[model samples]
Target chain A: MYLHHHPFCPHSRFVRLLLAEYGLEPELVEERVWERRPGFLALNPSGETPVIVEEMAASVPGAFIIAEYLDETRGLALGTHRLLPEDPAGRVEVRRLTQWFNEKMYVESTEPLVRERIHKRYMSREQGGGSPDATSLRMARANLRYHLKYIGWLAKARKWLAGERLSQADLAAAAHLSVADYLGDVPWDEDEHARDWYARIKSRPTFRALLTESIPGMPPSKTYADLDF
Target chain B: MYLHHHPFCPHSRFVRLLLAEYGLEPELVEERVWERRPGFLALNPSGETPVIVEEMAASVPGAFIIAEYLDETRGLALGTHRLLPEDPAGRVEVRRLTQWFNEKMYVESTEPLVRERIHKRYMSREQGGGSPDATSLRMARANLRYHLKYIGWLAKARKWLAGERLSQADLAAAAHLSVADYLGDVPWDEDEHARDWYARIKSRPTFRALLTESIPGMPPSKTYADLDF
Candidate 1:
């Protein structure tokens, strides 16, 4: 399998974590989506990242669809360790949170923050590259604080974000949060519950790969890889 | 079941059509999401519509999550008529297109058009209401044309949007298009294949409810409900 992705994209990070958790490895091909390459667009008309092409050439696009695809194909192999719950209600919560992180949180915080801080640097002048927009950065930072409070509330109320067990909800939230954390945007000190939750997930064997990933001149925050942080 | 939704919201329409197809009836509660009602926000903090509350009070939120929840809880009884294909690849296609319409198409076309041309009409001045922004309307119209051509290409290439069988992909696309058609925004004559496909799906018995629906003052376009148009 070959996975077309970008390390800085949280959606891509979500899928990578899922693949690792499922013990499946794909040849990761980093894609600069802003370039809008025709070949990549053909793979995914949306020109988004984290598209998985099977050995047989069936391509699965979008992190949400890819998560369901991976679980449908391999969840049975992992038995109880599956990221998706078996019951309908449990699955609903898992998916709702997945959508929350990928769409709601993404539009509100991650997409703007990442686009302004990370993606723009990789883009050319004609591709909308420049210094980050201060207004957008300010709005995203404020939104992130509100989101962290919500995450803290959720962590305090449940064993996992979805329910009693770890599911895609945790992975999805962690995936987006990790991206912001890498840029030193997450105010972890203000939300202890969220901080502890992140610490637990960050220490997982599956998270090691992400810790080592970095952009050439843009290093991750100092404590990004520290398990104790 | 109780569905909190707005008639013109395509995501809500997608779930409504799915419920009709599955033969489950829900008490429809029209919600103006912009009001941000405390009750509605409790059900879905995202303040979006198409949230379903089951008889036992299990709240399933979001169109995509609700689609999966409905299928999982009831699809086995559907036998060969399941909206989600049984095979992994086909299921992926069905979901990929579902997301395409709900997120990509909605963002590019439906949301902007409806918000500007329809939603703002119902909002108070304090809520950012006024004349539609001409620039947004122009952009959404152009995007709709591009999307229609893509739909036309897909319609001509396959028996259904996803495959040979009718699935949520068809329902999702038609749901969004039906809303646009209601406003006379769809250029049906420009793409014969898309028009034909819409005609086929629009004639389904499950589509009856949506066809008969109308806003208080914003009556549907002349041909919105004409099966033979």
Candidate 2:
């Protein structure tokens, strides 16, 4: 199986982290989704990455479907341990948590940062020259507190976000944090539970590729690579 | 089992239509999600409806989970005639189509209509009982055409969307069209495939209730009740 992915996309990174934890490496092909290549469009008209292709199957599909397919085909026990819940309520919580991190967190935090600092270069549109607009960065910074607070609240209430199992909630949360970590947007000092959660999640063997990610003209925070962080 | 629904909520209506088609009926209890009452939030914090309570389950769940539960527990012979597809690709398509109708189509079309027109009574912040903005209505009207056109395109190419079996796609599309039909937003004249598809979907015994719907402020189109149309 091959994954069409972009380093900056949180969803793509979410799948990558899971594959990392599961120790299943795929042929990683970077896709510039916004560029709209005809060949890529043929694979996924939605123009979104995290598209997985199984050599035996029909066509490309999105992340959730691929995760499910992986579970079914590989008989991967990773879900039960690291990415999914043992029970129904736990599973729903995990899915809801995953959606919360991927969509809500992206809207509130990542989007503004990406638009101001990353989108222009990827689209080759010179808006603000991909500079971090002060207001957007401020907003992204403020929003991160709320997300972290929420995660902290969840972590304080349970051993893990999706319950006793480490689950996809951990992976999904880590994916968002990876972007924030890359952008230096995460406020690690705000919440102990959230901070501790991130430390454990990032220390995983699968997180090595993520730590090495470097976007042009942008650098990780000094503490980003710190294992203790 | 009971359903908490709004007549035009595609998810609620889709579940209703599915129940009807499968020769079952649940008591219906309608709730306006925007009100955000504690009672409704207890059932689903998302504030969306079409929640079902089953006697067999330890607890009730939100729509998709509930529907899947029903499909499993009801002992219904939906095997070949199932709304959900069996093949992984087909299943993914059907699930995505369901999400498309419930999430994207609702976001794109239905919510604007109900929020601006039907839901104005519920949106109390408008001190003047503010008239529905013509610009948004116009945009929504145009969007509905595109949505139906896309559905028409999908219907034309496949035997049944997700293919070759009368699945929930038909029910989902029919539910959305029924709501639009009630508000006279549907443009059957714009696409032949959509027009014909609606005719066949509504002709089912399940669609009889949709035909009888009437809102005090806005009556359904003259042809709304005409099944043969």
TM-score of chain A of each: 0.98, 0.91
Give TM per candidate. 0.98, 0.88
- Candidate 1 lDDT tens digits, B1-229: 8999999999999999999999999999999999999999999988999899987757999999999988888988888999999999999889988999998899999999999999999999999899999999989989999888988999999988888989999999999999999999999989999999999999999999999998888889987999998
* Predictions in order: lDDT: 0.92, 0.74
Tens-digit per-residue lDDT, A1-229, candidate 2: 7888988888889889877767788899898766777887787756677877768775545655555555445534654564664455555667667767877788888767776767666565442444457987899889989999988998888888878878777888888887887777787888999888788878878788889889878778876888896
Compared with the true structure, what per-residue lDDT tens digits does model 1 show for residues A1-229?
8999999899999998999899988899999999988999999989999899998857999999999988889988988888999988889889988988898899999999999999898788999999999999999999999989988999999988888888898999999999999999999999999999999999999999999999888889977989998
Best by TM-score: 1
The numbered model that scores best in lDDT is 1
Fnat by candidate, in order: 0.88, 0.08
Clashes within 3 Å, all models in order: 0, 5
Query: Which 10 consecutive positions of candidate 2 chain A have the poorest summed lDDT?
Result: A123-132
